[model samples]
Target: MTSHNPHGHALASHTLPGHDHHAAERARSVADHAAAVVELLRPLREMDRIETLPLSQALGRALVQDVAAPLSLPPFANSQMDGYAVRSGDLSDGGTHLRIMPPVPAGSSPQPLEPGAAAPIMTGAMIPAGADAVVPIEKAVPDHFLDPAKTTANTPASTAGNGNGATVRLPGTAAGTFVRSVGSDIAAGERALAAGTCLGPAQLGLLAALGLAEVTVFKAVTVLLVTTGDEVVEPGQPLPPGKIYDSNGTLLEAAMKQAGLLVRRAGISTDNPAELRALLRTEGQGADLVVTTGGVSKGAYEVVRQAMADQPVDFLHVAMQPGGPQGLGTFDGVPFLGFPGNPVSCLVSFEMFLRPALTELLGAPARRLPLRARLSLGEPGGQLTSPGHKHQVRRGSLQPDGTVRLEGGESSHLMHALAGSNVLVHIPAGVTELADGNEVEVWML
Candidate 1:
């Protein structure tokens, strides 16, 4: 059924049937589900704060504004190789000998090339004004000059003649050959990187080449992580009967970190609605988004649903597996997302929804993607899927042979299998099974 939030935005929630009795009419397509999520997050992206980060600390940050090159790349024409700098005209007739001028080291300045003269230049050294091309030292015939530091027109090896004289025979070359021209890579005042570009090593290196010490980037989206369920306990804590360690909180925190989001742990809330409501009020203040796990499913103790009853949060049963039950709303005016309690479900939800939306919204490069892998098991047929759900997430391990093998059953609560698996095997809706060697999409962890 469609409901309107406080902002008058459309909200959709579907009633899920049992696995054996799925109703396709009530299901939502994965694409549609994802679009709905992006819609909710669209406003958040525009609301992102802009900040300046030093180049040293900007790695992995997304740009908030376009960056223009302050100066042309290479700034000046320079030698592309350690060779003899000569006027292309001097060698136009074929191999001809020219007297070698002083050798130009990388940092040293050299006088312009004169008629019938050649200057020995090192790679990256400024090309003398009158020189139009460079002949690599190895490509030049005969004359060997002393090191640039010791060579000059007066040196014994720097004389004019054929053979023994400081004369090198260079073949005719085209103008600009082996010469790196200014602004070849990036012109001055041209855009170097677009807004929303994620700054990685290559991007940062590009900025460094342009002498940019800092960059303007959107502030990393801050995620306030709150996990629900009283049965969940922190890792290493005493696990009393019927209580499992809270894995969703830890899992999401790490996942958010990898996605470049700043994560804050608000710890786990019990199945108490009043307690969860209080926690949301306190923790949701400054966060760009708030995420909670569990307490939105059909269970009687759905604390998140009860706590957010008066709020804009809509508890949804999205047509996807391992994470069908979902939640989206505004908590204390901050966007909030509630994921299933299952470890695998929580992670899969983030991958299918939050990651993709954030990538577009933040202009960050997509960090995770599903890989096509053949099912390792030579099943008699394809895998089974929820009839109504358009997507299913299964625990899997990517095998060395380039296929992903299912490691656990389809049950969402199976954490052991989830822990053992290195990837999430995805099965699109309506597929009954796949014969051996059939390719399937898997999200590598």
Candidate 2:
């Protein structure tokens, strides 16, 4: 069965049937096909469900709406320095002495600046409406504006010079000097932050400065996770003969959680097609997407491959190492994604394919940060490749000097080595080899 999505894109329905002639068809590049799948699920993005969250709890979530500044930063003109606020026009070429008003502490409202007058203002204190410039206390003729040097020297001459009816000599300053004008940081009624921005400490701080206590953000995507294999057993259970603890349950679930998705794991499914299909149908009803690790290859006991056989899925061998077997399609009106059984392959598939597509659809952060770094082999002159394949990703450790050393051999089952590495080094197809210290693209894991 095949149909078109709401956007009219061709949504083919196929499955892995013993690698027959139809299964031999190649596909577009990984990027190309990944983008196509993302577009196909464009309508399922969680952006439509928006909720208001307090700014205190909104960090690390993407904002669903543009936030306009409610009030200008510095809401009133304020002093950026602990000094005297003055009108630039009140100062002469040599020096102009101005009568001082009462001190303006940070919390007190400052009196308006009169002609040929100045106000003692503390940092963050509102500048009198008429003041246009601020003279640092240290720069005043008596030099008393609380400079560290003046304070350490026990200088009382600074304020002592401003006795009754006394005028303080101040040098000319440019208008707006050391004065934070209204909306200097952010203007009232102007856009403070655009939508789709992931809020961090600084971003939330800006919103808080604009007096926003609550913000709106999109709902997180929910995934129905299924880990398969008869040999796969839960971690806490007693080990039976020929059974190993299922790490995919831990691995993929943690990955999905880190990607800001809601993950509901179906636990381990034995190698039974009927049981797998029933479990998928039971759990997948409420999920926006369905993901299964293992049982996606051509093995005889491949439960996911068998369960999704009748569904509209195209299982293929993508031209990539470790993560070759790929299956994805719409099943029961929900997007179903299948990944290889290997722990490393499963994680890599999420990073390379699902992360980008999901983040692009929902405007979330693409946490897979790729950096250009030098590739180093164990030996002085060495290279690595997956032969004819266009891209081979290997576990690697990025050294302090900005070179990545391959962690272990190119085996997908080496979960220990994968755990020890911090990055994935990409060796493109065209380059058959690379001498030690050759440049390559490194994805920060």
Candidate 3:
């Protein structure tokens, strides 16, 4: 039967038959529940389209297409040293001292070396023809020369010259020493950066080396955040009785920023159905996703549930402690996730469920931040027990040698414990007690 309330709203006591049996049957393992949620949201997920962006703006973006070398790197056969540039056939015992021709500096056109002659070429100068190797000035004696009659007055005679316009050279100094062959680093039309690669500093440098001014990359996700609670007060505000400073807003915002999402909005909302509805329906426009915390449970003043009552929402009790109540739905065509109000619960819920799903949909690497470590302290036989329906998350520290020391209490509202924690220990359902030194799976925050 349906009854009309004071506001003429129809209310029906929709109860499941055999409530105890339903509760027993509805409970599931953590893995099974997570898999079910993922499958449910898979159809609604979509990655953004690719766009071409300049190298300066492409940081933290995923590559959309393979980057091929436009031209061969080090496009020409150039000298790698500051000595001389010569072909590799002119070496002889008691090195042949040929009259030095005009010098070839860098950025000059390539000129063929005269037969049996050498040119004084600077480093990075294109190798000339005829001569085969370079003889560093340090190894060559500047003195041997032809007869004095053959010396021209224009020749600035070397101080070591014997007045015959000749220069002495040492043997074995003309071996293959400093020449970088063309295409030594990369060849033309070769794939330098593969498709689906995430562009970082090194990747950008490689693209720049290949002369790419711009590249194609996937668009980044934009998110909106709505923090909810009537007992919450903003930081720097004087806290009144029965009120506490809001921590979830700041913590969740920072976490989203660290995950590379552009957080468009983050603010606290009271338990007012009308105000919450307006924010959800209007404030989240143009956002790919909307996240909220609190008011999703069966409480007397749970405004979020009241606001979204007629909306398409799938409310479920996930098999995870401190973050059991979860709400997944689409509002105004944007995916919305409502997390538990507790600060630690909000963060843990994001890491365990939402983060992995979003990363997969955005073509990002999945969050596999698990660490294996031995428990350092023993727990009383009855202390570590949890209901069979939920996975309990506990705060812990991973010691230097891969041992885990449990930190503060496991309550979802304990922000101090969360602040001191570096890892979240995941105790699966049905595991009542674990002794010290047992291996546990942890997610490093």
- The root-mean-square deviation over C-alpha atoms between each candidate and the true structure, in angstroms, is 6.1, 7.3, 9.1
* Backbone collisions counted per model: 4, 3, 9
1 against 3, candidate with superior lDDT: 1
Task: Identify the leading candidate in terms of TM-score.
Answer: 1
Residues 119-221 of candidate 1 have per-residue lDDT tens digits of 9898999999899999988878754554545434454533346442356778888999999999988899999999889899999999999999998887788
Clashing pairs in 3: 87-131, 87-132, 87-133, 88-132, 89-132, 144-166, 144-167, 144-168, 145-166
Is 2 or 3 the stronger prediction by lDDT?
A: 2
Best by lDDT: 1
Give the poorly placed runs of model 2, Cα more than 4 Å off. Answer: 1-28, 46-48, 92-97, 140-163, 166-169
TM-score of each: 0.86, 0.84, 0.69
Error of 1 at 327 (Å): 0.7
Q: Model 3 over residues 286-401: C-alpha lDDT tens digits?
A: 88778888887766877777888887877666767777777878776667788888788889888877667645554443365888988777553324444454578888888999
Candidate 1 at 436: error in angstroms?
2.0
* CA lDDT scores, all candidates in order: 0.79, 0.77, 0.70
Off by over 4 Å in 3: 1-49, 72-187, 364-393, 396-406, 423-444
Ordered by lDDT, highest first, the candidates read: 1, 2, 3
